[model samples]
Target: MTTALFPPAPVSTWLVPLDDTADGVVASLGLARPEGAPASWLDADERARAARLHDATDRHRWLVSHVALRLLLGAALEVHPSAVSVVREACPRCGGPHGRPALGPSAGRPLRFSLSRSGGHALIALRRGLDVGVDLETATAGTPSPAAPATDGLARWVRTEALLKSTGEGLTRDPDAVALRPTAPGVWSEHVEGDDAAGPELVGPAPTVADLALPSPLVAAVAGPGLDRARVRVHLPATAAA
Candidate 1:
């Protein structure tokens, strides 16, 4: 991919071995208001969303989140930020408009991507010919319960979130309803479970899940069909990396 980016900043793309099928890349960026993003870059809807965030800090973070997202997407597609068109796919389970956001009518082969943000950072993931999902959660300051402290339970929760996003289920399925267990290093096995007359939790279709190597106070995971063996290239912006 070409490095034609806005603000003329250097971005790093780091590669690691993990793929059995779909090739992937993930870009990490700081959400603390980046340079070169004009208020005019946002449309009415985004502006409305930003307006809802009355706090100036929150508003700037939201704006920069979008700026980073557009920049990352633009780089992946090799187009101007304005040229990247995104459309929502129908929900796989409910057949509704509330589903994964994907690149629409763009150049080259259709690439699957996922975006996740937490605290002061964000992640954008792109994969070739495979559905992918990612989730990032900031650790709790004092006693982070489900998603903080980087405990086993927190890891389970993030995995559930990533899997749900991958399947376009979102919160429609309760996080507590999924059962997860570690099956390998930096990986977990999960299945949708429910009570039936036959048993307490019935095992169902499960997705490939793995933990991300982010720092403390920030836990993350990604899911897909073949992520158990995926080559996820994690990219850091050159400025932030230094």
Candidate 2:
């Protein structure tokens, strides 16, 4: 079994291998309602989106997840959290503007990140020069999303999610066309794209994915090209687990 990363002691910064603080990937898992997290940390648009969530818990979790994402990115870039700017790149499939979420022009251009939250828990991950994707699911969460559906189970589901997100072909790509082949324990190194077609990311080798060991009922995974699963680290409060 993999080691659980969530519910770690409340840590300020957990660094991965890097030349400076800005060079390495950072992944964090935390309770959605962190104490004293001000909604003002989010920009006007984020605050408005959070307010649109009908459920109180959903709204709170959305706020915390976005806040955590900005903070992590800001920390890596050595900027204030509020100074971070977010934008979405054009879709890889049709060149539409509603593609994967990305850093704006002023932010680190090569950095790629992904965020997923469920069951009042949030996971955020980012890496410089390499695209990264992450997914988290609670057992109570009924089914995998249709965008990246999995008939097998949770493990395969999250792994596939990381795959699609990393490729930046999200929602537009057909899931049935891509198949994962295992290369190591808890690791997937090969995926087949449909129609003999490849996206911008698919021009490279198949993405590598590793299942994350989270506390019970929470399954997670991260994917990227030539991913060093050991280097991905996450921090959480000690009291986060149910």
Candidate 3:
């Protein structure tokens, strides 16, 4: 059967393989550090943040992931690395509320972006004038614990959370207020409303969610306006060894 060709749109997505070193990622994006900016990853509160992450690997991964996101966004915007800023903020635990991450001087522009990382893969979505959110889940083998929630329930919860995050609404409200529906295996979407007092109401069809056919189990979902027609491209970093 012939597959239908997707018409191109302004929305662009890039999936970088985990093998890409932090430096390689920056170089690949053709981004350079702005003059007089500090070369290290640590911000003003690095010491406090380091104390919070007990696992060394987790800490490393977090740092690497943030760096990769900045590099990817920089490349897309053709801006210097130092000109992009990422802030770690909290989200609502129950509903579609997300916190705003710090942005550089260019924040006023119409650029919108989302980032997701799981296992050995990282995904980035970029679009203009649309609220965007992306999520990645690594599949695991074996049965879930009896106390663990059902797959459908988990998917719903995740979808709601992702939508909240996409709109810069973090866990500032009750998570139970949002409702989610699973459209397919490893794919889910939610309709959220009454969450953003000043933002547009999130209504209409959610973006298409799909699982990448990789060796490891991975589930990914994207949500945004006009996502149904937006063209998506996944990029695997060249540094990854096949």
Candidate 4:
């Protein structure tokens, strides 16, 4: 088992790369195929949505990668694979609502998780007693270049947007409704409220955003309580099982 160097109480984040190798693809696919698994394992709406993307290549890859991440994280927590289940929910990627995949009744433990992938890498975040969200982008010629500097304003905007997405709020509603405040180095706060309606007031403290050191063009962000210690673990397909 890969030992977590940090204290046990802190959040653990793992970033696994999906290489083009056969093993990498296989690992990812195992999670995508429902196979003999119970249909009830997924949420009703999520099952319907996944059915539509069953034949889509990009969607397949994304689902597989996400499943693999969930399995790995569950294992890390010493939870049995069969006891870990994901609810299929409509998680929009770009400007819509802020939502993260939910866990089934079997996953009622305090651990929370989120998944995101871009280019060829899949990122997973796992934390105890905190609502966590993670996003990763792999560097590729077709992807945004990391060498380009990130403007302070742009970084703030992207971080807040990502945080909102994690919270299940619709991103298309109003960008001006949320405010991001810099609290410390690489740390931010998200101040959210209802827009013109009696919407819920949200005040998330100490959200953290960091630039990952992946060889590819990638940006990873996380928003949650007690996320100051969020750290990334990189795993290649060959070494992941070990």
Model number with the top TM-score = 2
Please give the distance, in angstroms, between residue 33's alpha carbon in candidate 1 and its true position after superposition. 15
Clashes of each: 7, 0, 18, 8
lDDT of 1 by residue, 1-242 (tens): 35332232111222211111111112333222223434554456667888899887667666666655565666666666656677788875678876778777655655777777666666656666667788877677556555434454676778888877776677767677667777778777664344441112223444677787766777778876656533555554443235
Clashing pairs in 1: 18-229, 18-230, 18-231, 19-229, 19-230, 19-231, 139-217
Model 2, span 49-140: residue lDDT tens: 88899987677667767766776666566566677788888977778787989889897456677888766676777777777888887765
Runs off by more than 4 Å, candidate 2: 1-37, 141-152, 193-205, 238-242
lDDT of 3 by residue, 1-242 (tens): 00111123555555655555666655444445433433354344543564588887666565666666655555555555556655544443433323555444545566677777775667776666676776665655564413225544544444555566576664554457655555555544554455662333446544434333333455555666545532554444434345
Q: Which stretches of candidate 4 lie over 4 Å from their true place?
A: 2-9, 19-51, 54-56, 77-82, 88-99, 138-157, 170-173, 191-199, 202-213, 229-242
Error of 1 at 148 (Å): 7.5
Q: lDDT, candidate 2, residue 218? A: 70
Would you estimate the TM-scores of all the predictions? 0.72, 0.75, 0.65, 0.63
Error of 2 at 46 (Å): 1.3
Model 2, residue 153: distance off in Å is 1.6
Error of 4 at 229 (Å): 4.6
Cα misplacement distance, residue 48 of candidate 2 (Å): 2.0
